[model samples]
Target chain A: MMLAQDTREPFFRPEWVSRNADRIVEQLIEHAYLTSIAVGVGSLIAIPVGVYAYRHRRAYVPVTWLAGFLYTIPSLALFAFLTTYTGLTTLTAEIGLVSYTLLILIRNVVAGLEGVPRDTREAARAMGYTPRQLLWRVELPLAFPVIMAGIRVATVTIIGLVTVTSLIGKGGLGKFILQGIQRFFSTPIVVGAVLSVLLAILADVLLLGLQRALTPWARSRPRPEGAR
Target chain B: MSVVSEALAWLSDPVNWSGTAGIPNRVFEHVRISTVTVLAAAMIAVPVGLLIGHTGKGRFVVVTLSNVGRAIPSFAILGLALPVAIKLNLGLGFWPTFIALFALAIPPILTNTYVGVAGVDPDLVEAARGMGMADREILRRLEVRLAAPVIMVGLRTASVEVVATATLAALVAGGGLGRFIIDGFAVRDDARILGGAILVAALAICTELFMGGVEKLARPRTSTA
Candidate 1:
């Protein structure tokens, strides 16, 4: 607070903080919204595909691997390439982001679902539970831990990647960073960079909390008495 | 549209492969740049990771720092660093790209290295010490050998990711295969876009295969587990 008075630059001046505070808050919210939307959409798309593939086992390996490969494409290039067909707009960016997430989320979901100990599902089936009941009451609950771990990783990764969405002209912190670069001003760039780190941290913490909430079983189980 | 045909023609032209316009040369340079960055990041990340794991000190510090590295988002790092580079007249291109990709690649290498080493059977290490192996020898002869496969898996994944991501360096006008994809946008060339995408995808798979073979060769068989 004390250092700002010596700055000759207007934006760097102390008084500007009051004016920009709301915008910064709003920008952070907007950034969070965009990332959450992509994750939500990716989950919707991926869950069924993941479940279906997990059911079919051997047959889906090629297709799921293809999804994983596509998931590995760098976000920036994918957005730009999509823009050639879709044009530079929100739809293209959204589609690219969602597609990118599906690869991670779906594979994780499928892996998690498959990871459900076979005995549990068999017990559910033996107890005369319907297939739907098995999924909802048995498999889903047991699989929740691994599924959320995947989502947690995916969310943190997306929050960081969303900063690049500004390059496609989505007008978030990235725009400020890019503009600061163009104008040779470091404050806006610094603001963007600092917030990018903060955003990643906050997102990880939030998702970690959610993971814990969903996976109570993971923590409740103790390590074997003698184990490291 | 036609730009695709043109680029294809250019690429297919015997002259393109003959190193004219430094296309072949540029390909080698880009590969070299990307490969060196991945190796360099691994060199720094692996030992630091191994040290942290072997010592079992500052566990939180090491992990929290790696998480920050993972979270820093490559483009923002590049954006933040570029102005500093430009003003200092360090200029921008491969080195800047190398730094950014290196930062992005480290977390995977670091995390995997830590997991590979720390996850080793404690009893085995104890036995090795009981057998009177020196600390240095224990690390090189047993611990690292036991950990090699997992660490190599991480390197294999990280290298593919780095090559794909080095494409982003194009935004700052750093040359790589990303040019074909980004430039394809201005002209609306799907073929060029697809070609570039295919090339990147191929680059990833090729690196994975190459690394997988090396991983197998280095990995000790008949686990002492």
Candidate 2:
């Protein structure tokens, strides 16, 4: 039960922030570090699988469904399950985080590849482009926007999930949240929550910018008036 | 005991299935919370999404709101909700968890519904208008029928997400299968953690399968035209 006298400290005290700036920066860096590694490793696994699945029509549904099923498992459960085998290590957290990103990454990669027009493929072939050459020079460039969009979504989602990693004692900003909850201290909870949200939004905007830079052709095309 | 064997032993124990902290009761609480949250979210999101999509107005707002909602972490929302619950003397567990999960479920539903309705072929809508079909009638008979598959996909995604995240409710002192994992962590009991995780994973898989079936049923094979 909570105290009736409202004895809780204010969520954002200047003195606390000044004193804990180093710890705050450390947690922020740790949060970004974990998220980036998970997303990086997830994309490494997902991209080749996505490419193969896209090429093989028969394998697409089964592969995606499996990924989707994996995604359905709760993050906490996955973390706990992994901890049983891996113990309370970063490996457990990374495995759980990476699994969650696969579905989003694969689906987006496939969708991006599929969005390439038949005429474009035919034209590339007519120009004597091999499969590898076409994939590199034509298909991939066109698929950039969609693939980037997927990465953006996956990155943001993973950022959120990393907070749950604190449960396993590997959580960056999440440690503060857990600590706050255990002690009923509003300051750490508020700071952690705010920082996590800020990181998500910041990552999203950065990815959006990257998408625009990569897909310059998408922006160059003038839209028909009132089409939107 | 080996981790796997110990986990199985814990799961097989009949005593774990018949108390206030029993598996069955926890499962019930999880499902009930998820259902209520999803239903409440649908009620709020679907109608507003339909209005925006059908009228072709506020598309930017809907899209922006969905993006913002998605960007906000569920854990952060739960943390944010806790203080409010405590200050109001509304208890620390159920309501906070429920509200946070409810927030989590809304974005997918709202965005999907908006996209589905908005993506309905303009030709079909024009034809209905040409035939003097009322706007409401066109929305019901044509737009919604065609959009059924997308709406169902949204519902399926939201339901699965809510059910999975509801496990976090136990962290807030709410009742659910998460209790096992939380308690196990507190006590350094690997078997209990594994047992709880197994239950959560199983429940999530079942929810996905059930929602997948409903999504298939909602898919329309032939056009009403």
Best by TM-score: 2
lDDT of 2: 0.87
Q: How close is candidate 1 to the true structure, as a TM-score?
A: 0.84
- Model 1, A76-156: lDDT tens digits are 667765665676787777787787787778778787887787777888899999998998888778778777777877787
Each candidate's chain B TM-score? 0.86, 0.95
Model 2: CA > 4 A from native = A1-14, A119-130, A214-228, B126-142, B220-225
User: How would you encode candidate 2's per-residue C-alpha lDDT over A81-179 as one tens digit per residue?
Assistant: 999999899999999999999999999999999988888999999999999999999988888888888999899999999999999988888888877
TM-score of each: 0.84, 0.90
Best by DockQ: 2
What is the C-alpha lDDT profile of model 1 across B63-165, one tens digit per residue?
8866777677676777766555655556667666776778777888888788888888999999999999998888888878888888898788788778777
Cα misplacement distance, residue A127 of candidate 2 (Å)? 4.8
The weakest ten consecutive residues by lDDT in model 1 chain A span A1-10
